[model samples]
Each structure stands twice: as structure tokens, then as C-alpha cells.
Target: MLRGLTTVSHFSDDVPAAVAWYAELLGIEPYFQREVQGKLAYVEFRLGDYQHELGILDRRFAPPGAGTPGGTMTYWAVDDVEATYQRLLDLGGTAQQSPTEHGPGFVTASVIDPFGNQLGVMFNQHYLDVFTGRPA
Candidate 1:
């Protein structure tokens, strides 16, 4: 059995600026900002009911051999993938993939944030039905 997601983390050169942009994108301000280990680092913000943390650290602090804009990507499921994708575009996000059907009643799209972080918008009526114990 899988537990619910706890948090998603992203690395940024400028923590404050990243937080602000994300806040605007998500329409929520950070709930916590604090320094860690003698350096200005880490901010956590809520998205819907989930928590996302962004870390600000020196280049050397990056994971071993992790290049800038590491290939890691995060997808956030939304009720309306197309609308969310367009809203992100209007908010200055770079579109990576226009909305398209992925499977039976499933649609998805993606965009790159100002900081080069890829954000995906997804919708799956089947998955929703399964999770809610309803017929698809």
C-alpha cells in the first residue's frame, strides 16, 4: 500500500525569487521560510493541500554530478489539464507539451517554470473514479 505524498523538493539558485514565482503560480504564499546550517536556505510552501519545499544552496552543495536544471521532473494532477496549462502559459511558463490525450479519458500537458523547473498538468477521469471507488 502506498501512503500519500509528503513533499516535493526543488533546487534553486535564488530561493526567495523562486518562492515568489511559485507563490504567484500556485496562488499561495510560503507558509514557512528559514535558514539552515549557517546558510540562508530552504522554504516550504503549500500547494492545494500538499507541501512543496525549495532549497537554496551553493553550487557546490548540489548532489554529486547533478547538473543545473537536472532532468528530474514533477507532475501535478489537476481537474482541468488544458485550463491549468493555459493559465501557466499566461503566467509566463514555457510550454513543453500542449494538452493531449494520454489514455482513456486522460489528458496531460507540461510547462517549464521561470526557473527551468518542469511542471506537468494532468487529468485522468479513470484514476479519479478508481480512487473515489466510483465507476469510470
Candidate 2:
């Protein structure tokens, strides 16, 4: 049974550029990196209140025909979905979906990163409640 998210891996043709882009967006460098045969192959950043892992893996390791954008959409919790979405657009990400209110305490947005990965942001009251150790 799936318990919780451990790592979210994104494929990138240019690992270094992906790492730099993510570092800038996260405002911190990756805490860990790995090289395969002297070539950078992966980088991992620990972010958010839970310190979840965000991983950038060399596209060469991706599954067959997985280069195109379209797959699992992982939404990271944010304080301001609109502001975060705008920041992503300013950072060279293409908007996939503008900020939209799903219901009373939930707003969501998505963007396609420069490396062809979809990144989602959300402001969810339930997530905040659980994060704060309050009843969801």
C-alpha cells in the first residue's frame, strides 16, 4: 500500500541545466548528487516542510518513449498558488494550467518546466491541517 511520497523523479536531457534551474526555483542547491561513470546522472533536493525529495535524473535513464510531457502530476503544497504559478512562469516555465479554485479551500496550478516535466502547485487546507498535526 502506498503510504506517502518519498521522491518525485523528473527526467531531463540536460542534467546540469535541470539541476541549475531547480536550484534557482527552490532557492537552494541540491543536497545530494550522483555521477554515473564520471558523468552527472542525478541530483536530489530536500524541500518543503516534510523535506520531501525532488530528484532530477538523466533522461537517458528514462523509460522508452517517455520524453514527451504527460504523466503523473504531482502537486506540491504552497502558501500561495497564484504567486507560485506566476514565479514559475517568470522562471521560464510554460503555463499548463492557470490557478484555479477547486473548492472552498483548494486552489491548483500547473506548469511545464523547461525540461518538459509538469510541475504542479496547490494551496490545500487539508494538506496544511495534516502538516500542522491537526485533523484533516
Clashes of each: 0, 0
Residue 13 accuracy (lDDT) in model 1? 68
Residue lDDT tens for model 2, 65-92: 7656776789999999999999999999
Error of 1 at 49 (Å): 5.0
Assess candidate 1 and give its lDDT: 0.70
Which numbered prediction scores highest in TM-score against the true structure? Answer: 2
Question: Total clashes, candidate 2?
Answer: 0
Q: Where's the lowest-lDDT run of ten residues in candidate 2?
A: 63-72
Rate residue 112 of model 2 by lDDT. Answer: 94
Question: Superposing all C-alpha atoms, what RMSD in Å does each candidate have to the true structure?
Answer: 3.9, 2.0
